[model samples]
Target: MSDRDTIHAHIEAHIGEHIANIQRLVQQPSVSLEKTGLRECAALLVSNMMAAGFTEAETVDVGDDYPGVWGMVDCGKPTTMLIYGHYDVRPVGTEAWTHPPFSGEAIPFDGFPKVVLGRGAAAQKGPLQAWINAVSSILSVEGALPVNLIFLIEGAELLGSPNYGKLFERYRDRLAQVSALYGPKTAQDASGAVSMTLGYKGLIYLEFVASTQSTGLGPQGGAVHSATSVVVDNPVWRLLHAMASLTDDTGRTIAIPELAAMMAQAKPIADWERPLLDAMRAGVAGKDPNGFIPGLAPQFPVKTFKEEVAPADLLQRYMYGPSFNISGLRSGYTGPGTKSFLLPDTATATCDLRVISEVGAQDIIAIIRRHLDSAGFPDITIRVMAAYDWYQTSLESSLIRATLATLDAYDCPRTIWPVQGFGGPWAHFAKLLGIPSLQGGSPGHGARLATSDEFLVVEGDGKVASLATIERYYVDLIYAFAAVTKQ
Candidate 1:
């Protein structure tokens, strides 16, 4: 048999072991939001990388409670690519789940044969472990990897990857050899079609806070009777009004004129985006009705866009639209039953805005602040959590070309997205470090990230890729990317 065929068979031969590795990673809790089990998870990953045959694997302190994990395998190849992933995951609140959030059990799913259900299955843990397993198989089968690898998994990706700057400073010398950054998301539809996203939208994550301390107009000495709210200015009501001013009652469009004007003035389409955008108009629109909406539309089959949204307008709104969304809101009396009488002193609303390249995070923050102040809610403070602008990589880049070639070879239908609504710190950090960035993954479908019952499909139908197939595809991607780098 050919060497490629032999390697693919080897992945299947040890598929059970590969799956066990993923489950082990998934079982470890690394919720970054609560600062829970992060160090233990990092240590567990260090052990996993060492077992997977990395020359060196260890976690480095980045001047925070959370640490960044770094690992490298030197196969004596000239070309070196850096793989970026998050070791930390979103906090799983008291939401009901099909299985325990960290069980990592291969349960029988409705559509797919089996899936590993957990908190970080699709977001980071599942894909990260699969990456390690793929490299291990390549080494076992070929005795060496095609390209050298450097893994830089952050523990604070949900916090906008603030520590990445310190990581770059600490590893400046070692990272000089890296050519590009590969941020792998589990990018497969039920039909097994995957998207090659050229760029990602930027993000400004912040919290809107209103309290007696900040506003000085609310109930002062803690709990007050709801009857007193007639005289006392409720901070929660004031904050809600401020939030409402940012959007209409439906909360679909941005009500801030400055932000909308900024969106209109921004570049309609970038030069590098044209090729993929044109391809998307033809490929994604025809292949799927929802047009590559990722985990939400394809998996759940819901109406994500406006009803009867033409592919062009749907793609435009997705690619360039700016948005303001309240991720979470909290005050008093959201418990099992209502605390009808008590009014709390403080209320907070966690929110985020997606920005295109034309818009800036600073601009968004300033606009929000100005709007809130002008709207007579001067005391409501905008607590900036994390912020970064968007970025795009050319289709002609070696990293992207190699990835597309590999996807073609694997027989997975590819849809090229010019840009998507998802936000990540990959663009800011990759550009800051002067490396091209590419985001992709193998032919596996996963869903429910940042929510309950998050899962990654391990066994697939004829269309979707199984765990073994996903691992083998990663191996082929390494070889394909390596070959293109030589040119």
Candidate 2:
């Protein structure tokens, strides 16, 4: 048998063990938001990396927040590859679940594929462990890796990676030799097709706060009876009016001048993106009459669109569209039946805007401030909660070509998303550090991320099961990338 075949054999033989490792990771609660078990999980990751034949592995202090984990394996090869992933997970709120959020329970149902139900099973821990297992299997059989590998797993991703930029700057010299960044595929559609996204949109999370203290026109000290609202100004009503002015009647279209200009500057979809966009259109068209499209429908429901839009237009809007959303709003009691009617003294609303490459958080905040002031609502303060810019890599880059070749070899259905609608810290490495990064690897389907009943599929080898597909894909990817960067 060839060396590659031997490597695959090793991976297949240890599939059970790999699943066990992933289960172990899933069982540990490493919610960064609550500062729970982060150090323990970081230490556990280091130990696993060392066992997988890394030359050195340890957790590095990013800041006062949770520390970031790092590991290196120098295989005496010229090409160096960096793998990025997060060790942190969202807090498991008091939501009902079929199984405990961190139980790592493997259950099989009649009609659906077998899966491991847990909080972090898919949004990252599963793929992270899969990569570690792939490295272990390759080394156990081949005695050495084909290229130098560097692993950077952070614990602050869910919190917008607040300290990752500092971590990268501190380790810039050591990481300068890294040629490319790649990681496991964390998303899969309802049709069970996996996607390789080349880039992601930027994000600007902000909060609009209105209080009686800031503006004497609103209620003060405490909530007054609803009857007094006639004489007193209601902060809730004032805040709602301010929010309404930001959007037109359609609600999707931004009314702010700066935001409109930024969206107008977005270049038309390029030629290379046509094929993938067409494939996405076909997938959306194939959905049941009442069924929702995988990525687009659930977020932007058909009923919510102001006008009838074609599939391609919808896809383009999702890929390149600048979005403004009200994630949450708060003012008075929202409990069960009812409480004493009163005008809330303070009203606050949380909002998020997904930006393209041309716009930024500061710019958006400034424009919103100007819009509010000019519209006669300057008392509403705009507080930035978090922010990050977006980035895209060239399709012809060596890393992307290698990734495409690897996916083709595995016979995986290839849908190349030119840009993902969500936000991430891709700018740190892709644009700031000037290294090309691509997101592809492992095939697993997950839904309800950060919500109740979150799950990652666990099953045997085949096109249907993700366990074997992920294991085999990583093995092939390592070899394919090594060949692409041969010195």
Candidate 3:
């Protein structure tokens, strides 16, 4: 039998085993913020990799809370394929779920088939499981993979991957060996058509605390009564005015000089986005394009929103360019009713800056500090809450070609995305280590990520991507990587 045929057979033979292992992986709670089951999750991934013929599997400890899992299967070829994914998940925010968060229950639904409801079903655990399953299935059938393989799994993805730089620095040699990188296809539409994801936007988050001395008459600094309003300058007003200087009525125009400067150099919107933007403008055509809007309003120009909010335009704004947003703010009194007092000491606001290409968090923070200082709000203190670099792979890269080939092999509809709208720390894999990273995955239809009802559909046949469908994606990927590397 042909090598491709043999790999497909192997995957088919042990499909059930793959599902059970996926359930086991999903069951482990690896919330990074709470430090819940992080190391255990890393160890679990190591075990799975080892089981899948990766002879050298080790959890690289970078110190801090959670470490990364690194493993490799050497085929003695010059070409190496690196795979990047996170093992950590975000906190289960306030949401009442139909099933327990970490139960890993694969119970049968009434009108539908069975499913695995748990934490990380869509945000990532399920897709990670599928990768492991694919590797195991290939090994079961062929006894050896076609191309050299490397696995880089981080445990602190949700916390903005703080220690990822240190880890990447330490493993530079191992990462340089990669000739191509593999990522899941996350491109999909509401109609259920699937596509491949090419790249993701980057993020830099900042928290600014504006403060002043306690403004009061008493030695103990107690707030003054309503009579003091005319004499005392409210810190809240000062903070609000300073923030107002950053943006105009329409959020589209940012007032910060340095931020505007950096954005000037951002890559022009890609061609694929035009059609999608047109679609979105048609969907939601209510708001004016020129005026500043909150929520989804900024995405579509008033004329475009008058049309529809195309899925493509929504995706483009997220993947490419720099986006600025004020995430949250805190300043004073609504206790019971209206307690008459301007907050004395401080008012703070957290801002999120999403970057596309070369914007650095530390650099951006310095620029912002300078801008605020020049704007006469030197008292506004800037803190780097989180930072993640942008990641992009050439559409013409052999890795992308291989991915497209795999999709074709499985008869999966192919809608190509230049990048995902939301940003990620994928730069830890791409820029830091020069590893190509993509954020697509088989999270599946109707999987609600971040919400409590997150669940994974499991047909009785036990195929994560429909037995025949997933097997082809795996087999084709193995074949394509092997061929590309051999050249």
Candidate 4:
């Protein structure tokens, strides 16, 4: 049998182990946002990584609070690759769920023959375990993988990667040796069509806190009675005016001409990427392009998107568009009744700009700062909460070719988004380590990431890849990447 065929067989033989390990991983709650089960999950990952043939696996201190899990498989190969991931799962709030957040039960649900339901099932824990199982299968079948492997199991990915500074301080030297880094999401749409993405947008989270003392706006000292509002300047109004200038009336397009021009200039889609983007937007293999959009229907009660509020072109806006969002706005007291008689001392508005490539976070912040100042809202203080630049991989890189080759080998209908709208700290890999990075992984259909009733489909209905298929795809990808990238 071929080496890959043998590895696939090994994965099949150990499929039960894979599912159980995935369940076990999920059952351990590692919500970094809440500082729960972090080091414990890191320790669990360390144990699994060691068992999966990693030469080294251990939890490293990430500045403080949340610790990161680091592992490496030294196969004595020149080609080394890092798989970036977050072991941390989003917080499981008080929402009622089909199953307990960490139950991790495998049952038939939502048209899939079998699925594992849990808090990180669709988002990460499931996919992360799949990679480990793939590594284990390859090791069991061939005794060694084709290339060296490294793992960065982050714990604070949700918190804008505040721990990245010290995490890099720890892994800088080892990371410098890696040929490339890849984030393997490999999640399939509900329609069984898979999507490929080459890059992720950056993020800038800023909180505008307007107050009498902090920003020199509104009534001095504490809130004055609303009777004085006719003469006194309201900080809330000032914050609103400053934020309103960010976007046009549609609230989708940037109103700032300079920022808009920067995004447009950065958005010249490469010649090769154009076809991939078109394939995604036009739909692939007879699948509806609209199926790729979640929570989209012909109509929904809770405010469906329209061109006025969102872009008319879904792919164009999703891939290259920058989003200006007001996460939270608070100014006054509306507890039981009228506090409207008095103005609040401070008004705070937390917002985020999902930035694109070629636009640095500092530069974006500078632009926003200048815009607010020039618009005569200098009293509005822009407090940067979190900021990270965008990151992308070159289409011409051997790693990119290897990834595409692996995706194509499955013979599944795949669509490609030249770049994803979400944000991650991938640029650190590129700028700090010189390791170009791409995000995605093997095919598997899953849903409800960071929401209620999350699940990863275990059995495919002849279209989507099952967990076993995903593992096999990773095994194939490792060999393919090693083959192309190695001299």
How many pairs of residues collide in each model?
0, 0, 23, 4
Model 3, global lDDT? 0.66
Compose the digit string of candidate 1's lDDT tens values, residues 407-447.
88888887777777877767655566666787774577888
Residue 114 accuracy (lDDT) in model 4: 95
Best model number under lDDT: 1
Instruction: Give one digit per residue, the lDDT tens place, for model 2 in 219-281.
Output: 777787889877889888889999999999878799988668777788567788777677777
| Candidate 4 C-alpha error for residue 280, in Å | 3.2
Consecutive 10-residue window with the lowest summed lDDT within model 4:
294-303
Please identify model 1 stretches exceeding 4 Å from their true place. 1-10, 33-36, 61-66, 75-77, 89-101, 111-114, 141-144, 156-176, 248-252, 255-257, 270-272, 282-292, 295-312, 333-336, 373-378, 448-454
Q: Each model's TM-score? A: 0.86, 0.85, 0.79, 0.86
List model 4 lDDT by residue over 237-309, tens digit each: 7777777888898787888877888877656777887777776655533443354453344232334444533
Q: What is candidate 2's CA lDDT for residue 445?
A: 69
Off by over 4 Å in 4: 93-95, 216-235, 248-253, 264-266, 284-290, 294-312, 331-345, 431-434
Clash-forming residue pairs, model 4: 183-440, 184-440, 185-440, 186-441
Candidate 2: worst 10 consecutive residues by lDDT? Answer: 288-297
RMSD list, candidates in order = 3.5, 3.5, 5.6, 3.7
User: Which tens-of-lDDT digit does each residue in 411-433 have in candidate 3?
Assistant: 55545555665565556666765
lDDT of each: 0.81, 0.78, 0.66, 0.80
> Once model 2 is optimally superposed onto the true structure by TM-score, how far is the C-alpha of residue 233 displaced, in angstroms?
5.7
